[model samples]
Target: MGFRDIAMFNDSLLAKKAWRLLKNPKSLFNKVFKARFFPNYTIMEAKHTSGGSHTWNSILHGRDVLLRGCWRIGNGKAISIWQHHWLPRKHPPQVLSPMVDSLADAKVAILIEETSRQWNHEMIDGIFTPMEAKLVKAIQLSRYEAEDSLFWPFTNDGIYTSKSGYRFLKAEDQSEVEEEQRANLLRLNKTTISSHQIAATAKERLAEFALTIPRPQYPRVASTPFQTRWLPPSQGLVKINCDDATFKDQKKSGIGVAIRDENGMVLASMAKHLRQLYTALEIEAMAPSTALTFATQVGFHNGILESDSLVLTTALINNSTYLSTDGLLMEDIRFNASYFNQLLYSHVKREGNKVAHKLVRHALCILDFSVWMEDVLPPIRSAVLDDIVGFS
Candidate 1:
């Protein structure tokens, strides 16, 4: 079996065990509690209670790892602003100093305007530090007025998984590497950018930097409407349609990419959430970058890439120019696009790309990035089916 099959099989086995040990009330150990198992709240809250059976002790032992990647979504009533990890940005939203006594015990709801059901900007501005205030302002209010809820940051379905947990822990190593790279880049910048050069022609240098970057071998083909319908890839090829959804208020966005066979049957898909970004177009540009990365990793050679972003489409077709920071990103995109032995880029209208759009929206609410092969996620299944039906 392939990697995808192995991953699915392992996940299936884990899901089955999780259901039995955690959700099945009829299980002997669950019967001891006389209640359903709650890994996050109930069991975790009772951590100090004198332990019971081996199973319960084992579950408690694993809680620490699980809790590391989980965060609370505050609805105001059920979670305290200061006590809980309600803000999704960090493990616990960083506060350099403790809050004043007046607001020490305040509920997250206090920051919500009762009538508007949104953040009370005045209250937030008056109380929080600038950084904290920005984070608070970016938070999306609870729409259903539901109590605080636990979110698993490692899974697309908001369900916990060992793979996600490992990924969460692995990020620390990646961060360290990134930090070192950033420091080196800063040192280079300081050494290379002379005072005369900085004053002489900043635009000229910027343009030079943009053009100096090497690009892929993909021909500079202007993006044209290939097939407006949900057409599949040609035989022996895969079509990857990618889209990005931005949640400006939440300071987050998601990338949705779907890969399909010539029959229009989905082979794999991804919905990945990222921290809030500067521009939607930047994120849009990322769709192709991500798609190409996944394609090359999976050993796909011939592919056609589709996106709804005209800006990204144009950038890829035309020669690089120092228009903005996006020019740098476009250079990277072009370099990656060359990985496929035969790759083509196309632009499609939003209507023809609903499946990818839906996938991106679904990604926004998820805690971690998700990838599916063979089995499509429930949210995007209908969208996938709709595309297939259109071919009929």
Candidate 2:
């Protein structure tokens, strides 16, 4: 019943982003990353610089899929004749014929008529084999000098979607995926994951578990419902609690985020109202990226991110099954995640996520987005105080 690999799905999701980088040269994401990683080169020609991120490495690994896709030549100035995949119906989507020494480093622009925007048949014949010349002449040139773009032949519309990319990756590299990755699981459960970066969660859960063991039948004393309330992060790490609200009638949604330090004091809180209709599930899924972005904006580079949405929390985990369930959403989530030094995704019950929920309830008063520093909104003030007072 199951046949997909998490690693391959991860690659598939990241693969489609190559097209984004190629298409939108001026986007903020492209400008920031391109300046640091690629610098004055097209994404197709970009190399991994030393001291780059693991996320960047994983993204480049997916470029092979994009490499196999052919460029639909238009201006052709953007595409390389020899290195890029532009030839039609070829297995490698490039000229199989050996390149002549003179044309070794050329752009497809040189093979086209300047004003007419048509292929130069004479040039094609002189440079390539007869078969290659025939195929080159057969490819239609755009009349309007439209920009060059990549196309995946495996897809009917010549566009790449994560689902299609996943299927393609599964067929292309079955041997590379491991058994555990296929199951979307981890063996960390049986092992003690000791790391200083980890929030003090293991001990908390272990202490809670100690309360439930059958051997502990001492005089029954009343206990605070700490398990049902918001908890602070480990001593140094901050925690961001995220939640969402949906309006069915007006068809608008709201997102709320509460960022707090290990001392349980509110560092910042965000409430933004959406003008468009969205389902509860969709809005909940939107919370993590919003929260992470807010954290980055406010200068918190690393922390614990808690959410009531099990789907999102699990999806945020590496190689988790829910990750593949919403590949595109997680793609954006992972993109935002790379902005952090260390971030941990934690799943909390709805009861523990009240502060953010309260902020969502207060979203109706705000127009687009509202953020408060070193304070809580009046609606969530009580919740924040209670949380701080309750912390052990």
Candidate 3:
């Protein structure tokens, strides 16, 4: 059966007379109130106990009266005359006026007004708490009213009636105030000196030290030594390998590079951490520089410098501007690369550069200087080396 048919069948079990009664407005109202409010209100109780209780009994009674008035209106009855006249106006005045009078008599109202004035002086004078001023006010007002002094009962010396009084001239009080002021002055002096010292140190240490260094002049392509000679037949074609090294949290980083020839053998391998923190592009440049430096040092000037960082490879090939934003380390990479007479830098995918990647990972794991050499280098000429060899 459909949903409406099911609902009709469910309702059909109810007696006809009862179902007709449910249609009446009064019946609906009774049902709503009985289901919603009646159970909660019927079970609520007001009992006084010895434990700490709220002082405002009239507030509770006022709320109950308001709720009953609402119930009457909901049942189609007019609000009571007393509720209409007194309930709207009486309780606020009764509750608030007594509280105001009590605060005024206790001199708390004056104390509150004077607190802002005292706070301003305290901020400038380095004294913060209002306890002393509050005590003074209490003492003076108690004497005026001829009441028992609350603060005096806790102190051996009676309260000073005036600043010119002999009690104010006592040595102990003067000495105590002087000692507190002296301590505060010393603290302020130390803080000022410390701040000035930090500023001066920063001025001295953080200022940039720029040096003028001569840029290397590139030799004519024909005059380059690597261009003048061909690779020996015994020396296989050049292959470039590139990879990155990672430290703990991958925060400290280094790049590893190796140059090999066609026979799957290593010609030269070098690894060095970028002395300063570097972005991926800088790391990529460092990898090529490492390979090129190794190649030049070992007299293999004609070699490919491969890198996993495409951006760095492109920048090097195009001889684009190198940014000094990462500080001198980026410039250092460029300076180092200028020494390579016949360098071919290429960007290779990480998968294609697995050998150098493994070398970097190995260097990081070893935590010491390492070198590997093979007499028979790889045979591929001008080909990038991508073979990853397991560490033995």
Best by TM-score: 2
- The superposed Cα distance between candidate 3 and the true structure at residue 57, in angstroms, equals 77
lDDT of 1 at 87: 53
Model 1 lDDT at residue 229: 66
* TM-score quality measure for candidate 3: 0.34
Regions of candidate 1 where Cα sits further than 4 Å from its true position = 1-31, 34-41, 72-74, 91-97, 170-224, 229-392
Error of 2 at 143 (Å): 31
lDDT of each: 0.66, 0.76, 0.41
TM-score of every prediction relative to native:
0.43, 0.44, 0.34
Better of 2 and 3 by lDDT: 2
Rank by TM-score (best first) = 2, 1, 3
Worst 10 residues of 1 by lDDT: 319-328
lDDT of 3: 0.41
lDDT of 2 at 84: 84
Which scores greater on lDDT, model 1 or model 3?
1
Tens digit per residue, CA lDDT, model 1, 1-392? 66754544444444334334543557776565545444444443545345466655555555545445434444566556665554545535434435878888787778887777678889888888887887777665433354454445455334555666545544544566666776787878843333335556788878889898986797677785645667777899988889887787887788988888887788888888887664665576677888888778767879888888876776566643422323335555676777778888778888778878888888977798888886468867887788888886
Instruction: TM-score winner between 2 and 3, please give it.
Output: 2
